[model samples]
Target: MSTGHVEYASLNGTHIFKLIGEVRAHSCISLDKLLNKIEQQQNVVGAIVDLTQTTFIDSTVLGVLAKLGLKLKQVHHIQAVMLSTNPDITTLANSMGLGQVFVILNYCGDPSVCTLELTEEQHVTHSAMLNTVLDAHKTLMRLNENNQNMFEPLVKQLQKEQDCLNHDVQKQNA
Candidate 1:
């Protein structure tokens, strides 16, 4: 039910776009359009997609990114960068073999803390990689916390039922 919005900005010589809100089937159309526009930019050397604000991203979104990466590579010779703290999203991206296709950056609050290692013509340091990982970890933790809160009641109810079942078995034995 969440809507996805993308905000574009030029930062540190990179065309940075932050994907805000939920990335679902409906949002993919708009996202695809935006990506097409970004791809057409002559000044864009590379692209960084910030998914920290994105609460949900489905497989369709991943496919779109994969296609975009391919197009960018073939046409502009530009690489893509993914910046997100969502483990599910990250894991999905990794599973789809998109990790090797794009440069995944780790971002803590300050984007500067994150360093990107570019294979094309730019080389970055490992510390920057660490920072990016740390940032992603922070986002993962937040998602975990939110998930825990959402499931706490169901967990407690299941625990209560389990306790009751155990008590009934003991009574029958007695």
Candidate 2:
């Protein structure tokens, strides 16, 4: 059985990320961390996402990707190239209107030829994951009206869970 993985490297001013295996909601935690760091970078001139080895991507990961693309564009005026050979993924991306942010491709540049190592996964709490999911969906909703319509229910559900979690933490503290 294959687990999800997110690997990354920075070559000069170009940042490259490779998402492998099954990318699920939990993967968003790590991806969001990277994205936060990426957003703070000033030297990055371009970005690429390799999904060639990605077997599946959950909505949370997809939201993280959307956030990445929007950030790169807003910060650096760069359009992110998303590499994927899976027809299903490509179709799904199109259906979800991700093409507005990402330039989906079937192949990557020579970055894949380099020796890249996986980033160590940071352990995160269930609450943290839910928080990440909530933020990710909010980012998606901010993209456009269509996304807002599609993800409003999910965002509300996540927000409700987050509120409950916060209340539980307060009770525990009390």
Per candidate, the number of residue pairs that clash is 1, 0
Residue-wise C-alpha lDDT for candidate 2, range 1-174, written one tens digit per residue: 228778777888888888878877866666688789989988888888888878898777888888899999998899998988889888877666678899999874464355364554467788887888898789878877888999999999989999999999999999
* Highest TM-score against the true fold, candidate: 2
Query: For residue 24, what is the lDDT in candidate 2?
Result: 79
- Give the lDDT of residue 161 in candidate 1: 58
> Ten residues in a row with the worst lDDT in model 1?
113-122
Segments of candidate 1 deviating more than 4 angstroms: 11-13, 109-174
Worst 10 residues of 2 by lDDT: 111-120
Predicted candidate 1 versus true structure: per-residue lDDT over 1-174, tens digit per residue: 446655566654476656666665444454555566767777667777777767777554565566666667777787788887877767766666566557776663455434332111124333333333232233222334543464455445545655676687799999
Candidate 2 runs further than 4 Å off: 108-112, 115-122, 172-174
Per-prediction TM-score, please? Answer: 0.55, 0.87
lDDT (C-alpha) at residue 156 in model 1: 57
- Error in Å for residue 54 of model 2: 1.6
| Total colliding residue pairs, candidate 1 | 1
